[model samples]
Target chain A: MSFRGAVVTFPGSNCDRDMAVALEAVSGVPAIRVWHGDAELPADLDFIALPGGFSYGDYLRSGAMAARSPVMQSVIEAARRGVPVLGVCNGFQVLTEAGLLPGALMRNASQHFICRNVKLKVENSQSLFTAGYSAGQILSIPVAHHDGNYFADDATLDRLEGEGRVAFRYAETVNGSARDIAGVLNEAGNVLGMMPHPERAIEDALGSSDGRALFESAIRSLVEA
Target chain B: MKVRIHVSLKPGVLDPQGRAIHHALEGLGFEGVNDVRAGREIELDVDDSVSDEALDAMCKQLLANMVIENYRIERVAA
Candidate 1:
């Protein structure tokens, strides 16, 4: 059976196409496009991606409106059923707002939008999303956002770290995130949310193939399971 | 009925936008500005029959994110 994936698109989503293309290239299957208003996903989807961009123009808060959209309700149910969900950049903010992940993505402490490639250390190699990366391996991924700084209480941070739920950590401080967290996995290890754009780094044309392994690993896990 | 909701970040939560505005005021030579914190105000028009419990539910569910912010609701006679 071929790998099946879907990419959700919101009004201001710019990276949905890139995420679909990346999934298609890596999984050898066409990705279904789902709009934010749709109440359900395509049947039997192996992966669902919430790509980057200013959904709802970042109004009220980053991802606040999008998180409450019609489609996210279905996505939340699907994620609970064990389907893999990957949220990138603004999508990360959505997941947090939707309560799929703990904490909030607040504005950078510097109060300036940051756009650059930053180094990330793979912190958990056991998650479905990070199995292809070795623990402690540093890779460069592009991060561009005004509200990417991660914040949670100390106890929540400690719990996430102790439970091996932190998937990636910034090798250097880029956005003033608490504890330099770049990415995290849900308790079930199926849902992953990260600020960096791995989809943007998946090919040599982008000057990096560091992100290809992430897609490849998801596809591999789907096929093997 | 008219209701006013004031949503403010929790005291311990960092307010980056508010901090930036404070710095801008300082740059403009505004002296002795003790502190600055930013919050939001929302007004709602509702039926006179709407109950207090229902309005509180609205604030708890959507008008405020309790994790980092608190909200005050005021009801005004229409």
Candidate 2:
């Protein structure tokens, strides 16, 4: 079966094309482009991606406006139905605002916009997005954001850790994310949100091919399942 | 009616902007400044018929992120 993936684009979303290119490169199928104003998603989507960018010009809050967009309503419903969803950087903020995931992304502790390749250790390799990586493996992915600091209460943090929902952790202190959490999975493990841009690292020419495994993992599982 | 929605980070949440402001204030030779936390005040004009329940709902649903922020709604009489 052919892989079916869709990339959602909100106004001010600059990385939507990159995300689409990465998905097509790996899945051998062009990803459908969905607009934030649309209330319905394309049918039979096996995977959905929310790419990084300052949605709504970071007004009110990063990803706050985009999270409430019409398309997100369908995206949230799709995620609840077990369709694999991947949120990268600003997309991660949207997930939290939309209540599809836990925690919030705040201003970086350094108070500066970060744009560089950082190391991330794969913490959970059993999920649909990380199945290609081995547990404890470190991958270099590019991150670019000002408000990528992840925050959650202690009990919620402990619960997420206990439930094996921490999918990736920063190998180094790149951001002030609580407990160095770089990525997380929803309770069901079908939804993954991360600060780094995996789509930007899908090729060696892009400085690293480490991110290819993420897309391949989703495609591999959908093909077999 | 005029409504002011004050949105603030929940206690214990790190406030980097507030910290930056504190540093700037210290640079200006100010003393006895213990701490600084930043918040937003949004003003809205709505009909008097808009009930308190709806105002609270608006704050909870969109004006505030329950995970890390708290919002208080205040109505100012015209």
Candidate 3:
């Protein structure tokens, strides 16, 4: 069966096309485009992606408004049902705001919008998202955002680490995230949220093909299941 | 009713914007300032029919992020 990936687009979502293209390039199936205002998601979706962008113009807070949008209700339900969901950058922020994940993305420590490629180490290669990479493998991916500082209480941080839920960590100090976490998986291991734009790094021509493996990993998991 | 919601970063949570404001204050030679933390104030003009519980729920659900910030709701005479 062809991969049924859906890319959700909010009013200010800028990377929806990139996410769709990445999914299509790897899965050989066009990703269904979902609007933020819609109350329902495409049925039987194999994957759902919340691409990076300043949804609702980052009003009130980044991803805060978008998280409460009509469609996120369905997305949240879909995620809870064990459907694979990947939220990148602002999408990551939304996932946190929606309570699908723990922690919050705050302003960068430098108080500047950082845009560049940073090195990330695969912390857990067992989840559906990171299975394509080996543990401790360092991959360079691009990140661009003003609020990517990940913050969680000490107890919560410990729990996330203890549970092998920290999927990726920054190899270098790119943001002021606690323990330099770049990506994380929910307790169920099906939902993944990350700050780096893996969708932008699907090919070597774009500086690195490291992100292709992320999409490949999701596809491979479905095929094996 | 005039309701105001004050949202401030919880203590111990780093506030980069507040720090930046502090640096600017120091650069301007403002003295005796121990520290600076930033917060937001949102005023809502709601009908008297809106209950306190509804206002608190609004603060919790949308006006303030409960993770890194705390919000206090104040009702003032219009």
Candidate 4:
């Protein structure tokens, strides 16, 4: 069976094409490009992607406006229905804003718009989006954002740690994220949000293909299930 | 009804923007600045029928992210 996915494009989204291309490369099928204004998602989608980039001009806050937009409501519902969702960078912000994920992405402690490739440790390879990697494996990925500092209450952080919901953690401190967390999964493990752009690093020509494993993992989970 | 919402990062969350501003102020020879924190203020002219619960809901749902920020609403006129 062919894999089905959709990459939502918001008004300021710039990485939607990259995400779509990466999804197609992994699934061997063209992924649907969705619009933020659309209230309904393409039905029966195995995967949904919230790609990186400034949405709503980063107004009020990054990903804040787009999180409340019409399309995200449907995306949130689909996630609740067991469809896997991936949110990178601004998409991560949207998920948190939509209450689909815990914690928040605050301004970087350095107060700079950081843009660079960083190493992330595969903390939990059991989730749908990360099963392709081994536990504690360090993978180089790209991160670019002004507000990637992850903030959560100590109790929530402890809970996430105890439940093994922390999907990826930074090998070194790239931002002031709590416990160096880079990616996280919901309690159900169906939604994954990360500060790094896996789509940006999926192509070997682009420098790092470690990110390819995430897309492949999602596809594999859908196909085998 | 006129209302103002003030949003600020929860205590213990580092505010680098505020720190930088504090440094800049010190560079200009201003003293006695014990601390600095950054926040935003949003003013709204809502209908008279809008209740306190509705205003609080808006803050919790959209105006503020409770995880890292807090919001206070003050109604000037109704």
Q: Per-candidate TM vs. native?
A: 0.97, 0.99, 0.99, 0.98
lDDT of 4 at A153: 88
Q: What CAPRI grade goes to candidate 2?
A: high
Candidate 3 error regions (>4 Å): none
Candidate 2 vs candidate 4: the lDDT winner is: 2
Model 3, residue A162: displacement in angstroms?
A: 0.2
Worst 10 residues of 2 chain B by lDDT: B58-67
Best by DockQ: 3
Q: Deviation in angstroms for A110 in model 1? A: 1.2
Model 4 Cα lDDT, one tens digit per residue, A1-225: 778899999999988999999999989999999999998999889999998999999898888999999999899999999999999999999999989999999889888888999999999999989999999999999999999999898999999999999999999988889899999999999999999999988888999999999999899989999
Ranking by lDDT: 3, 2, 4, 1
* lDDT for A28 (candidate 2): 93
DockQ of the candidate models in sequence: 0.67, 0.92, 0.96, 0.87
lDDT of 1 at A6: 93
Residue lDDT tens for model 1, B8-71: 9888888988888899999999999977899999999999888889988988767777667889
Assess each prediction's global lDDT (C-alpha) against the native. 0.91, 0.95, 0.96, 0.93
Candidate chain B TM-scores, in order: 0.91, 0.98, 0.96, 0.95
lDDT tens digits by residue: candidate 1, A2-55 = 777999999999899999999988987889999999988888888999999999
Instruction: Name model 1 segments beyond 4 Å from true.
Output: none
